[model samples]
Target chain A: MSINKIQEITSKNNARLTWEGCSILLDINDGERMVFERLTAGATLKVGNKKCSLQPLINCPFGSLFQVENGTDGPFLSRIFSTSEGSNDLQEEKESPTVYGSKDNRELMDNNTAQSLTGEDIDELRRKGASGVEIIEALITNSATFEKKTSFSQEKYRLKKQKKYSPRVLLRRPTARSICEAYFKKRPEQIGFLRMDALALLLSMASVTSHSDVLVVDMVGGLLTGAVAERLGGNGYVCNTYRGITPYPIDIVRMFNFGTEICERIVNSSLTELCATSNVTSVSSSQLEEACGTRSQSNEEGPSSSVPSLDMGEIMISSEDGDTDISPASLAVKPCKATKVGQKAPLDAIKSWRENGFSSLIIAAPQIDAWSMVKELLPLLSFSAPFAVYHQYQQPLALCMHNLQVGKMAIGLQISEPWLREYQVLPSRTHPHMQMSTSGGYILSGTRIFGSK
Target chain B: MLSMELENKVSFKRCIREGDLVIVYERHDNMKAVKVCENGVLQNRFGVFKHSDWIGKPFGSKVFSNKGGFIYLLAPTAELWTLVLSHRTQILYVADISFVIMYLEIIPGCLVLESGTGSGSLTTSLARAVAPTGHVYTFDFHDQRASSAREDFEKTGLSSLVTVGVRDIQGEGFPDEFIGQADSVFLDLPQPWLAIPSAGKMLKEDGVLCSFSPCIEQVQRSCETLKSCFTDIRTFEILLRSYEVRGERLESWENHAGGSLGSRKRRQRSTDGSNGVEASVSATIVARPSSEGRGHTGYLTFARLRCVI
Candidate 1:
């Protein structure tokens, strides 16, 4: 009951909203329309045959629709962001007039009856004042395949036309979902092989609630950290153990518009600092951990513009305990401080870290030894706390699962790859889509069994 | 520090104090949710285990039974709770549940409507997904099942954010009071097509709707209905497989003799228990797919409600 009460009090601020400075994820109407792309305000974009104006006002709020000159016939706006409680004056965008009704059973004409329309005519018509849907109607009437195609192909043809003709552009505040869509579909290499579907499973398997205290060693450019923070909704904490001068994932995290309170909950500490903070430390253990947090800072990427540099006060607490004495020898080899990035992590988070002992732990760093990371972090989890480690290649997680099995530290070890196939649900001809992504990374989820073995 | 452990706040601490729903993990399949009482006993195959003894032990701490057998007293989380809860009907596992939660775009403070509450497994996750600020209005046709789910909601401490309505969603659409209120609507019924109209009506402008069906025929019918009322329609099926791996440490006496580790001991024989032995060139871990792999729960069809001015 208290969890419910706590949730009600906190959920108010998490709703999506739009403003002048908001970083919005726009579902672009291009051939690659399936992929959502990030766009900031005050930047003009070339939409399909049209110039999309994106002038932002000072703290201006965005709404679902806006009326433009001769805009009544265009395709409806799918969505835009606004505050939860307010009623905006903007008019709602209407659905496309050429509705593909499920009951449409019109007989098709023979193939020889009509020839495909010329590209020149379509270009001329588009230059004229015809809407995308209008041009699509012309395409259907002129195309030779129109008469011979099945209902599914007909629908597909219409969609192709919609994408080609419609110059629709939208601006909405970036949520974890949008940020995930932008990265996973657009820049898969940048975020590793982690897909949005896979990320969802990882979060759910870990039971990441609004009140969860989580531990993450995410190498997917801070996606996991931002996602956990979003679910936390400003409650609890996220300990992100890093291996560099600055945390890698902060760039994507800042786009979600998580408030200062939520940002504070995302505690950043070097992997070295984290391993050093552990109550039980050995020379070998510390030496192996050095490979974790002490990355020669890569200043090559330059500073990410959207993310605010973290304050140093949060990072320096680790040294105060002096529990694991900072080795003078290792510090002497400190990588040159080129354009000093983010903040230095303090050890203070360890005090709280020792108390809660993290309800869930996630390792998505494919570059690091996931088994070693799991071994070091197992003792830091609450009893029965679920942890999910992700790797594009199955061998690493397989080894981790084996080590966990041998060490008796984990149970219910599952390696899951979500099989996704989109459906082509057209009238009278529904089937699986022809093309789909085969893999979306692999996940090994299990519980930390801290019981006596 | 003291304030963090408020009576109202539920957290995984070391002890099973009063009001904690401890998950008695017997195995992956055999598990139970036991309410910790001052004088209570959990009688399982392990033996008679008193709740009094478990009251002060840390969660995941192993307590011996009167007959010398033992089991783990683990903390109850949403994911674990899903696996252990008594099944009243087929439920959504973590795989599909995660997919639905993400694609449906449900987040904190979003109002969601769920029909045919069945086992409340997905509902439990849904409740957690929209916690503290969001609420899940769940409806089930069966009177007994609906009331039972409501009771379960109270026991699981989700009553505050979820409401169990005992109306037939397909027969009589979601109560008119919620006609244009829900941020998202979910249908898990035999004829979700009949409920699609109601779902669309209840959804706010540009709100999303998801229907879970096991068969493709049901998916086809649902998509047909959805095309008339929604946009951006998609269908997905999620599969989860587990891998159980075992490690064996091998020592050699003849071929490719392995060197001895740091002068801890002098041994002529091979033992399988020693770990991280430098003398051994590699740690051979044998991994195989686990016997229990849940296949094809259902196809999740998600669509965004078309903005109808």
Candidate 2:
């Protein structure tokens, strides 16, 4: 009956529009800052020094844009409708490239007097009810070097001022790619430096599909678990197995707007329980209950929650003190206690896994040695099932690959490193980003073969 | 390649059955898709192998040829199918394919659109991502290529999830019936800018679109067109560098000098007994990037449809 209820909810929730309790990724000032928050009535998002309620964003669709405006009450986020003028400007610029000035910046000076507007003057303008755009215009009119700059630099100057005066927030859905990117950008260590490209490779290498049972060792928080669960879409089980009775903390799963159906499919079981001989089911069930008890106790302690060390108050305070460049921080403000995920795998599910074996396996335990762990876990997968192991360092995966080859337990073994480089594709200036991630770690992928035994 | 039905799933009891499409793997790079019939026999570099020997065996079984050479019979997965599919056009490899799927935010029950069905390499993986509940409508200009892709999807058991049409999307855009119904659209065409307007019309609010091109000029033009109705446009080039691993034993030169890392004591004993080899030899697993690999694929530019409502 609960499964049917969740199925009904899944069909209703297409995940296109934000709801009262849905999670959202807030991209502030075009990725100058990124924050994660729930869309409850009381949830507040701080843009610069102004803390505004997120109520206006509740019913809006993902990819909607909101601008921070100084309302009668205070500063608030207002929805920004798309305008055709932006595209017209771009089109005109493309058509008339020669209209850009040939002037150089040789006469430009680095002196602070380029802008006559002071902090107090800007505050005074704000008090006078001058909009952000009006203040920008006033500043430009008063600037001594406004006419001396090249057209390109003028556009750059305007963009810089826009970011500081009128901040914009773009609502983004927290999919696996966006979630991995957020963590990878802000806190790489939390997710074991698993870049989005590397994460995608893991999913593909393991062949995660609907209706396929997936076994995972998600030590890099809950990123791998949530990703597999998203691909499964509530059809099959994503069983997270651990070395001991305690399972890894998968708080990242909460960031996804997975309905009750998808959440129910994400379960956990210890390695011993999954590999326990058939006769030992009764003893393992008792152990499973014991593990469940400890898990709930840990959850109460709150150590197994969202990304550790995300201090929302500190980021807001730092930005409010006129620190323009604020390092992005993941803020989990009262994550609505939605349906529970990562529950202990039921006895039936465990028994079924033991009999049928998992369709595929993905291991992202950066702390564990790949060879030792894979040696213990590979047999739980059905013959011909693919597996991918993630590690920040290549030596571990290399040794794992060597051992697998020597033992003849797997075939098609290869260790791969993902190279991801972003480009700035502009009209006349298209090049790779000035800085890029040197490495996205390594993965050892192979397919399990039936041992002669 | 996918288990659509529970009974068809790979399990301890699920054996190689008739009419099964299996990937015959000789090496990591050497693989072929084979349709198993009762009287089917396969001839390869190793030797002649009879299909009857593999009928009752489970997938991943190592079946020996008549001349004693052996190879593996693996249950087909989308990844392996990509490697074995016929190259009707320049196909997308795993790196670009994986990145595109993730960046597009595709999941189950999502309607996806693609163009140029180039060899159906990416389409196979796309079908896997949106299987059992979703559908993929892919169009190509070449009728022969479209038909071949359809047959390939049929062989891989993905026909129910994908529909291949013979239409030049760059010239005629997508079918009008899919207006505002697609969760994501992917364009891998020479002139993707020609299809940008239709793609914008077909996407639901906030739906994502990705364009793959090998040249920066195309990307430049597409971004100009996308600025009208898309937001958060970003471009990335993704590649995979494979490494070869080997267990190598290195001999220490200091062992010849009779002192290093406490090996002197062991060397003294071994020189009087054996050849003093055991003390200096150390076996360790080492890995390095393969000397040659794909240097360039295409740049993936992803953008989200701006929500106007």
Candidate 3:
């Protein structure tokens, strides 16, 4: 009970501090490895070969940086103050004009004998209580080519050595931006290769805002559901509708630091349930009853087996994402106090949706046919309500747009693929990133119209 | 233009009443905002459209002009408004605006600040993100621009969620009253570096800031200034590539090749008769990016306030 209360107090959408039992994103060594964890007394993070308890991270601000240090017990994480920020070296160098030395890399050899220090000597220094920074300094001092290298190569050498010896873990808030980027970079398949820009465009095109009734078909592992819920901010209802009896899993919504208020707003309902009151003639009553029966049976088994134990202390760091994995499942089980987010939508809410229709609709179900899904779901939106549908392939959306145009069911129809290019802005060295995602995906956006019916 | 209440939302029961703002959409690229009045009428290329004909009609209804030409009257949304708003200055489009909102992490309860509220394009979306419980404070140097933005907010029914002030944010910085209270800040000025320090002061720990510049040099200077009190500085350029779709009928090479002219004529005649003949016709849907699009908008540089106690 005490842990639950602590989580509630610190789980605000904009909370700055990391509380016990709270979810966090650990960025190790400038995104060399990213991990999501729940702060508990027994939780641990693996940096290099050593594992350290995360108890020291509780009650700290989100942007604090921690460096691994050798303590009496073993390797532990210690907070590095602002005075020793590693980025300061780069910042200071940029202040002065960078003048290339007369020396060139033509004389540099590819042989592996650049340093005189042996592995045994480094281990001896570690055993004698030398910190990671001190070890890096010692390695730099012993390198035979340290003085002969240009300033640029010298900085690169130091950066590479620092990553190996002293990796820093930056505490970051698990917002939609950071979470989407992590999933896209590490595991694009889980989220359907839905890039961050595409997700943002979908939310904007759908006009998701506070107090608006938004209908969504999120097949991309609940990333769409969670992004919509974050924008709803606990005011509007984000009703995730699906086909058949069983609802899709929304495991990613748990990554957001949403309090119970927002969690309650995220509900799910089957298409039959939503359309039952709308007098949809496609589904017969006998079939609807069978669907309901299956739903009730699944409901009985849902909480017992599907709901992972929210015990914070039992959480573990996922090692599969060796370099960048904000393991979604680990954070999904973090919010022990949250009333399950994807509960069955209440009957009264469904009744209102059938009567008034949803204010907006956003569909990201890549597995289903876009035109057929829109045909059944567009009528569920209020007249003049906007909608955005996302798909990895452009053909389905093109066909969907053409069909909608021919049917006169929507206006302002446009299929747009968002292109994002990131730039590395620096003094006299600003240019776009050499590599970027070619396609975030295509989105077909339009406003639903009032049919003659 | 927004649903301040449940009843205000577009629905079967909600219809166009007097004193409402509606977007008269003639085509995908043609739209204009008009306020509904009892005696108002709009004259355009389509024809003369009487406001009386639109009254009591549900939004998204296709209303006819006196000449039998018609146009759709849709309830205004932030995205639609961006396309139709008069450009008092170079405005932010959907691609840049959407990315900024997501990166800033704006929610319903977050307080946001912006400078040089040009045409109130992004401000409209910002107000939408921080509605029901939050607010957006926008400042511009030009008094007329600021007042025009105020009028636009009022017309859009977002006055309660936004405030437009006439202040030079670059020269004067944000007001002291907002010191350490803002959840996010945005800058779109010629010299954003001058306002970077004030944006840092106005943010809570871990709050985010964004600066939009049209040139790489400006981005270089802004990033340099941001390094003093911000972390995780990143710059991105987001553009939308719109695709046009159409169904094209192509003559199948295998069907048309090595066939006499009479056979080709016979095939054309039977194209609509059977599924096999239709398959030979190859009526396929194709999509391609539009020939011309916005090549560049600006560089968006985002940073987070350093969490130092």
TM-score of chain A, every prediction, order shown? 0.66, 0.87, 0.85
Could you give candidate 3's per-residue lDDT for residues A1-453 as a string of tens digits?
122222233228878888887878887766656677767888898766688999889999898888888776777988876633345444333323333343455644433477788989998988888888899899889988788776665675666666667777788898888888877866677788999999999999999998888999998878899899998878779998887666777767777788889989998878877777574345565765565566656554443234432232323445341322222222223433434778777656766787788999999987888999998889888899999999999999987887776667888888999999987776655667756789899999999888723
- Among all windows of ten consecutive residues in candidate 3 chain A, which has the lowest summed lDDT? A323-332
Off by over 4 Å in 3: A1-11, A83-103, A107-110, A279-339, B253-282
DockQ of the candidate models in sequence: 0.29, 0.44, 0.46
| Cα-based TM-score, every candidate | 0.76, 0.90, 0.89
lDDT of 2 by residue, A1-453 (tens): 122232233342357789998888998766667788878898898766679989999989888998888877777888999744433233223323233345554654435567788999999998887777888898899888878876554664565566678878889888898889987876788899999999999999999999989999998888999999999988999998887546788888888888888898998877776777533345566775665566445444432444443445433324331213233344333444645888777777877887788999999987889988899889888899999999999998887776676667789889999999887666665667766789899999999998722
- What is the Cα-based lDDT of residue B279 in candidate 1? 21
Model 3 lDDT per residue over B159-241, tens place: 98898889989999999988887889999999999999999999988899999999988999998899889988889999999
- The residue pairs in collision within model 3 are none
Tell me how many clashing residue pairs each candidate has: 16, 0, 0
By DockQ thresholds, what CAPRI class is model 2?
acceptable
Q: lDDT tens string, model 1, B43-116?
A: 98889998888887777777778999878877777788787878999988888888888877777667789999
- What is candidate 2's TM-score against the reference? 0.90
lDDT of 1 at B4: 21
